[model samples]
Target chain A: MSLNATLIAQLIVFLILVWFTMKFIWPPIMRAMDERAKRIADGLEAADRARKELADADTHAAEEIKKARAEAAVIIERANQQAGQIVDKARADAMLEAAKQKAQAQADIDNMAHRARAELRGQVATLAVQGAGKILGREVDAATHKALLDQLVEGI
Target chain B: MTTEAPSSSSYILHHLTYLQLDLRTWKIVENSQNFWVVNIDSIFFSVLLGLVFIGLFWPMARRATHGVPARWQNFVEVCTEFVDGQVKDAFHQKSKFVAPMALLVFFWVLFMNIMDLLPVDSLPTAAEAMGIGHLRVLPSSDPNITLSMSLTVFFLCFWYSFHCKGLKLVAREAFFHPFGKWLLPVNFVLKVVEELSKPLSLGLRLFGNMYAGEVIFILLAAMTLHYSAPAHLAPLTGTAFFIFSALALVTVGLVAYGKGPWMRAWLPLLILPAVIAAGSIFGFLPAIGGGAYFQILFATGWGIFHWLIIGLQAYIFMVLTVAYLSMAAEHH
Candidate 1:
């Protein structure tokens, strides 16, 4: 068909509008949307990572605490065992020393008793000799008196 | 008043006549002497028909669904798809605006064209009561409306050319293409003339076809007796036969004319023309030489049918505009 001034004018205006809208308006709007989407995605990802990291940290801390408590228990047990060994050794040594002392005391008492008995015997004999001299025939009697005392004790 | 009826000739003549606006010195002069002006009866009803179409489809515009479509939605979808297909086939451009514009144009023009199918008396009856003189509903039949729409399409075509090819390229194409540089001035003037003729031809084509159809219907209606005359003498039987035959011919002729896929080709050719003819003959053709009552009926019927045509015409015009724009942008 033939072209006309009015038709041409209309076509021009329509084209201008379409081109302008596509070039200037649509791009910015689309870009803005893209940017907004990316930002949202990034935000979500960060939140997810943060949640995971917190969980991991909590688990790691708990594990470290468990290991520490176990080590502390082991150390306490070792210390208790060393203390018990030292106490047992000390008790054994004390028992041995006490026995030695008791034995020495017993020996000293026996030796003192033997010496006193000998001295008493000597005194008694001297006393008996003086009494015999006084009573006529006591001089030779020390040995004889000793012998008689022995013989009478034997007989009884 | 019924002593003698008007002849069929008079009836048709009255319905075909119009109260025209005459321009004098760039101003509209009321009651200018000898200004050739007349109204096509179909136009009044056609515009009302257009309004109705707008009403029906307007609701669809508001709550569009992505899922299952309503009947109206489906209709609209089919219309848009058809228009889109036409645009895609005719004009190869990633035209940001052209396709949608074409869709609108096709639907509007299609609706406008379809308005011719309503009964002739629907709008005229109401118009008569309101004392409105000579309202025609078909925008395509109005040279002014057709010319305006076509001219807008032409404008889009040129605008795309200038925008895409640039003034330099347009000037070059006009002056240098298809001939040597030696014939630049002649070529330029010829190209300009050719470009200038697009809207003129487009508008005139539609107007002439529609106007002729309207005139035939008027002639047929005029064969009836005048309303004031006795009704028995009027040749209603003969008129009805002639109208029916003429409508059938128009419908058949319309269908046979187009070259397209079998199913859809028949619509643009057959149905469209039939609607146009029917709208003119039954809707607008009966109002002339009619009594107040007859005129009212004729007007109302025409109003009812013309709504389709108004929308169809608008859609067609919009589509043509977009297609031309796309072509110009790409070809240039």
Candidate 2:
């Protein structure tokens, strides 16, 4: 192959191509690739953060549920204690009222017995006085009869 | 096959000749001894291929996105990334110029080499129809074109060496480091040869490979002329039938050897040409006729093999350029 001016022409062309590529072709493509790499990195980091936050939320929800369950148990235990105290007080009040009524009934029975006894004794004295008068077969002295009636009454 | 066919030697010469323009005479010439002559065909094809490269890449470069890319954009991005990776591997220092230059060298050379795969006569024959006397479609096959590219890369190396190492160190290292200043003249000569050989090897290696490949294709084409004569038909037909039968045996052997997918896929590529050549020889396919089938068979085979050379040469050229530049830029 002969060396000719064609070599120079081709050299010029090659240089032009190199310049064109450097000026127009290389930078934008490199920038895009770099930007894409950054975007992917950011996306992965965001996904990692969201996963961590989700784990945190899961633990917090578990704790809240645990606390709510404990509070519910305490309220139930207090209600049961209050219910027992109310039932015991009601039973004690009913027993005290029953004992007081029984006592009053006993008092009323004793007082009524005393009044009936007094009336019966007076009737017996009158009957004895009448029988003595019949035995005497005449009118006896009143003052002497009064003292004897009293003694008869006291004996009845 | 034409009514009056050219002799095989003349056909081969005609294919190899360039459509050169003589600057001294200011006219297209058959052949020129003038130093000012330019091979118009090589220049035209090389420049067109370069334009095609830039045109295809320019749009993608303009619209490149950080988001998901379109299919064509993806292809361009892959090529860019591949070239960038090669440059990054070889040239550790950051330089805006090297990667793009590598990209241009690779794709441009690749495009030029691919022209060889076009049926050797297709473009030249069409070019002939347009009153062009001679045309060689492959630019890399031309010494001027390959040397021009390699020389440009060599210039970049010189620029980087001087810029990075500075004048004193470069001269001192050139004259001293490889051997020593005690043998100054010897070191100088050795350095000169070593420095010159980088571009020489880069340019000539590509030219030799592509030139040899083109010559083989021309020879395969010339075979059609050789065998198209009635006197040669019997031998041609006999050879075709032999090759067909041999290929059949190979196919059978491959099938018996556990029929790998690669064997299945490639066997057809090897067999199809033989089938056509044989069929044409036997008058089973009279349309192609005669020894034209031989051209088809060998050309197809060579063209397939040349595909590897085309891609490989381009890659080698790019990688070597990057390596040379990296070496030039490296600090002692």
Candidate 3:
């Protein structure tokens, strides 16, 4: 076959084929490939983000537990210190009350013993005056003693 | 071939002639068409092969998946990727059409070239049985087909050159290439020669190879069909060999002189001689071995080799077209 009408025919055929392929064939396949690539990229990014977030969450959880434990420890320590302070204050108050009570008792005992000695001294003085009055055959007043009687009582 | 004995030359001639129809006369004209004549075979086969391509690929493209592919889809995908790879390698501009157009040129030309490797007698004999006179199946063997396909590529180059360079730049490049403003005529001549040769070589290289290949097959077929004597085979086969050699040498000269990839021009220098020598030797062997055995060996060997040539020519045609388009589309 020489070049003639067949050139036109082949050209038309070639044009039609190229058109068909460009319109129908190339775009969808390429788009699918591109979409698949994008999806893969997106998935990988999401997975990476998830992994990072998971790590962050894990660290956060661990830190929170540690913080809670530290807070609990602090609370316990404060409670123990408060408890010790409360006990020490109660013991000191008790000791101070006990010492006050003991001092009061000693004071009371000293006052009672001094009163007894004074009562005894007063009784002996009265008795000595009465004995003197009896030996002189006379009752003497402790309130108004004469000078001579006072000197004789002093010598007795 | 002829009345009594199938003359080797007329056998080749008979096979070479295409079935043409004169539209003016509305009659099947074997030869001598001064007016609107069509190679009925070429048009029919080109259209048919085009339809075949559409039928085969359209569904695959329609149902194409991004995930794992089915068997036929894989084929389509591979073909698509191959053509796209060629375009991506050669053409850098972001034209939407080049990759698919490359795919078109590749598969269409590949299918047409494949028709040549079939048993030469099978289709013609079948057509004759169906009351058809002649059918030349290999459309790529027809210079009309190759030239017209290249004609489209030439137009694309023209369009893209203007598109990328603008008319002013294209004109400037044509007139002011290697030489400055003073030597416009020389530069113009050189630019015209260079640009014109792109499509000319593209068309003729494929046409020459396929045409020579057809002629060789016809020659070999004729040798075994007619010549029983060893002496009768050599000159006939040698004549065919030189014809192929001469065609290769002319194209080699063109590709050697042409400014594009110079290595491609030298490939024929390697392939053509080996094929011619083998064909001639095989043509000689048939006379001693009584035709069928040697014919089978020769046919099978050449057929396998030609299948490779078919694929290579189609690939080369696609890549060269893309390269030329790339050059044309590059910014001035």
Candidate 4:
């Protein structure tokens, strides 16, 4: 064959090769590739979903923590208020007890003084009656004894 | 010498030649004078081969499962992905249809290439007995098939360019950018050459590689036949010679074994001896370098070892196609 003929033949063959392959082989290949890309996109979507769930859980946990802290603060404040009331009540009761003890002591002193005074008066009367009876020197009647005692008492 | 013994080289060359067909037309359209036609044996077998490929793959497509694919289904998916990945990497533009087109090119071309791996004498000898001639089964080896397939791809590329960019944009790319408005004539010429070269290079590359490999295998078989040992010597001294050779080989093996531990300490020392031994035993290793055996080796290696390439190529192609379509849709 001439060089030109050979080149033309080569050209024709080349054209045919390209034609057949493009028609038959390419479609299936592209379909498979599309399937693969879709699979990857799906995997990414799953990951995103998991991330969202995780973030929600974290937010929930933080909310729970804040609620618990608020509850603890209220309980602590209540306990402090109750403790202050108890201290104030104890002080008031102690002051009342001290005042009652002072009053009782004062009343006992007054009663002791009155009883001593009465005893002293009785002793003095007895001594005076004995001395008068000795001076009169007789087992006199009630009217004579009385008249002597009266004269002695008037002179002292 | 009563009959000259046929030399091994001549034997090999004879087997490799194609049976020719005459399809030339001389007077108007009645009788063809000297134009070639399809070899009867080749046509029958090539069709049969095409059917076999379709049969193998079509069923996988038909019974494609939706969820948690079976082994066969997975295999198909992997193969598809591999082709797509390659296409995506090579061509950046997304074609609504071009990526799939590239995929078809890869697989069909691959199937055609694999036909060369069949035994050299099997198909042709069978055809001869059946009174048929000019059998050429491997389509990749045929320039006609390869070039035709490549040109189709080239045209598809042009179609995609035209469809995606529009006629005006394609024209601008062809005649405008590289050269200024002043050099539109020169730019047009260069563009034409560039466009023409695509299919020519692509088709020729695949065809030449496959055909050369087929020629080499035929040559190797001829060598084995020519180097056949004597007939009478097989019975008489064959057993004694075998025993002697076996003993020598055993001794050599023992020496090599003893040297292995020492050799392990120094890799450089062992490399030469290993190469020599391997070369002598395998007879220079078939197909030298990058021949048919090499091509098969490379293809098989790619299939087995660099499997990632196949899948990646498929993926890239698919994504690019999608991206292109999305862009084109926006324009519309």
Candidate 5:
């Protein structure tokens, strides 16, 4: 085939195709590829940030839980100590009250003993006075006898 | 068979002829080419396939997704990316046209070169059936078609050189290079030759190789076929048939697998003649189909090997185009 009109036609087709491809085909696909690359990069960055945040949150939560637990332990120990002090205070108060009541009861018993002794002496004096009167065959007076009885009691 | 086919030589010659249209007369011509006459088959196929190439990519370009691409889109994208990468590597200056241009060149040549794989007789047989004649489909095999492409590249070379280097330096470099300003005349002639050779070789190399390959296919086709059976050879029977078959098979194997220097040297002298004689002897045996078995062996073998050549030719054309452009654009 001699070089002819076909060359021109083919060259035109070649140029047109090349131009069409350059203008329309290339830019968009390349842009899409660039966009895709950026998306992937951004996605990976977000993932990295999220992982860091999650790790921080995990550590923070653990710290908060640990603090709460420690506070609870301290509270429990303080409560135990306070409870022991209360029990000791109650025991001390009860011991003091019991000692005071025992003293009061012993004092009452001593007072009753003293009264009985005085009463016994009076009875003895009266009986003695009455027997003297009976020997002398006369009646005994209470006013003079009372003084004597008191003196006799004092002497016993 | 098929309307009593012409002699094998005529078959081959007919296949080789192109459907030409004389531009001056505005009339169709065949059996010979004239000035201003173009091979319409090459033009038609080239234009048609060029459109198809663009058509294939057009949709992909439109709907090209940022996400997972469609299969066809992926294919187009990969090819584009490859060409883009190659251009980036080669050309220092970023030209918007380079990658897409390379893409067009590569796929266009690829599309044209692949036409060779179609069975040799298919197009011509179809043409004859249609009452038309002499349609060669493979466009790259035609020098006009290939040279047109390379000439386009050649124009671009100077275009870029003048554009990038400015007219003064281009003129200076063209007029004086290795021998310097003292030998301007020699340098001018040498420069012209050098410049002409770049595109010349690029175009002609592809043209020659492809033309040779087409010729070989034709020759192989010729081998299988015979117009008239040799009048002497009667139908074979008994031991003679087996012996001829054995000899033919051996010759075909030797011809097919014989890459050795001895076989290459002797093939024309001793081997081919022996095979032909055997083929005539076995021509009456319809199962063997004359010497066509050997033709089938070589054709199939070469056809298989031609896949690499097709891909490589397209690749080489593209790479050299880029290299030429790069040298022009970046050269100080």
Candidate 6:
């Protein structure tokens, strides 16, 4: 084919297409692409921040659990010590009560023994007087010997 | 089919001719060396294809989003980004014009070249019914269109050279740098030739590839023009060609779909049947009369291969334009 006016016509058409594309087509698409890129970057950054915060919260929760466990262990140990003291006081009180009861029983026994000894001595003296009266054929004065009998009882 | 069939050479010539119009006389042009004549068919097809490009992209451009893009928008973005990537790679300078210019050249040329893939006679025959004597659908095959595009790039190179390097530096480098001022005349002549050759080679390379491809398609179509002619051995040759082609198709299908170590081992042996099949087809070609079946086969194969050529030529044209502009922009 030979060079003709068509070449000029095509050149004009080509220029117009280029101009149209530059004016109407390129800017909007490029802007959208750049805006999308920025949005993606921001989303990724937010995700990273959320992950870091979650990790921090996980560590904090674990520390709190450990602290609560330690407090529980301390409270259990103090309760065990208090229980031991209460048991020791109860045993001491029981022993003191047993000792006091034993002392009371011993005092009752001693009083009874003294009364029996006095009665026996009075009977012996009456028998001695009766035998003398029988020998002398006369009664002696018993009221006069009461003081001696009382002293004899005390000595016994 | 027409009762009086055209000869094979005439068919081919008819396909090659363009629908031209003389601007001065305002009439259809045929067999004239007039400088004022324009190829109207090339202009119509090119402009129509350009409109198609704009139509496809303009809507998507309006709906482009910062969020997830629709499929059509994604496709448009992909094309835009690919051209942008090419412009950025070759032309390091930031300019508003180069990327869009490259996009226009690439898609416009690509659409023009794709016109070759249509059945060679389909549009021309329909156009003939409308009383248009001749039509060539592929615009890239016309030297006028390709040269016009290359010449535009040439002007762009000159514009950028003057803008970026200034006239003083460009003129100085043209006369002095390559061979020094001692050989200024030789350097100037060499530089001018070198500068002129860029557009020449750029335009002709595309025209040459497209023209050769168009010619082959026309010739393949011409092979079926003798359908009414009688051949003595037509039935036998036709049957033989069919059987061999079937065998070839089966072999190809097996290689494509069959799987396992046995298939791999049989791969080398497979070539034997293919070679024999090809040999038989060519051997029976002469006796097959019209050979319409063979024409279909060749056209299908060539059409598939031309897809690669079409896209590649457009890409090459766009890349070379960017490279030339970048070279012109350089100081030395």
Candidate 3 falls in which docking quality class?
acceptable
lDDT of 3 by residue, B1-332 (tens): 21335577766777877888888888888865453788998888888888778877776677877776665676777777778877888888899888888888898899899888755654554455345677898999988899889989999999989988899999989999788889999999999899889988999999988888877776667657743444344344434444554565565445433444444545556765675455445332324446645556777788888888898899999999899899998865
Q: By DockQ, who's the top model here?
A: 2
Where model 4 places Cα greater than 4 Å from the true spot, the runs are A1-81, A105-109, A112-156, B1-10, B17-36, B40-82, B89-93, B122-135, B154-198, B227-332
Error of 4 at B281 (Å): 17
lDDT of each: 0.55, 0.82, 0.76, 0.52, 0.77, 0.81
Q: TM-score per candidate, in order?
A: 0.48, 0.81, 0.67, 0.54, 0.78, 0.78
User: Of the candidates numbered 3 and 6, which has the greater TM-score value?
Assistant: 6
lDDT by residue (B1-332, candidate 4, tens digit) is: 00133577665655544444333531222112233443323334445545544554555565554455655557667866665565566545545455444444455445555556544543443344344433565655656555555565565566666777788877877787578789999989998887777667766666666666666655555544433333332222223333333444444434333355453344435554564344322332222333435434543444353234333332333343334333332322
Distance from true location, Cα of A28 in model 4, Å: 8.0
Error of 2 at B143 (Å): 0.6
lDDT of 1: 0.55
TM-score of structure candidate 2: 0.81
True contacts kept of each: 0.03, 0.85, 0.75, 0.11, 0.76, 0.75
For residues B1-332, write the lDDT of model 5, one tens digit per residue. 23344677776777888888888887888744455777889988898788767667776677878887655567877888898888888877878888888888899899888888755754554454445566898999988888888988999988999998999988888888869989999989998999899998999988888888888888887776763333232223223444554565576556434667665457646865675455433432323464656765777798899888888999999999999889888755
- Candidate 1 chain B: worst-modelled 10 consecutive residues by lDDT: B229-238
lDDT of 6 by residue, B1-332 (tens): 22246788777878878888999889997856787888899999999999878877887788889899865677888998999999999989878988888898899999999989766755664455346888899999999899999999999998899999888999998999788999999999999999999999999999999999999998887777765333333344444444554565466555533567555447638674665545344332333354657776898799899999999999999999999999998776
Q: How accurate is candidate 3 locally (lDDT)?
A: 0.76
Expressed as tens digits, the lDDT of each residue in B133-200 for candidate 2 is: 78898999999999988888889899999998899989998888767779999989998898899999
Local error of candidate 4 at residue A90 (angstroms): 2.6
Clashing pairs in 3: none
Q: Residue by residue across A1-156, what tens digits does model 5's lDDT show?
A: 466667776777777777887898778878877777788899999999999999999999999999999999999999999999999999999999999999999999999998888788768777778886898789877566777766766787
Better of 2 and 6 by lDDT: 2
> With candidate 2 superimposed using the best TM-score fit, by how many Å does residue A42's alpha carbon deviate from the native?
0.3
**In candidate 4, how many clashes are counted?**
52
Give the distance in Å from residue B122's predicted Cα in candidate 5 to where it truly belongs. 1.1
State the lDDT at B300 in candidate 3: 70
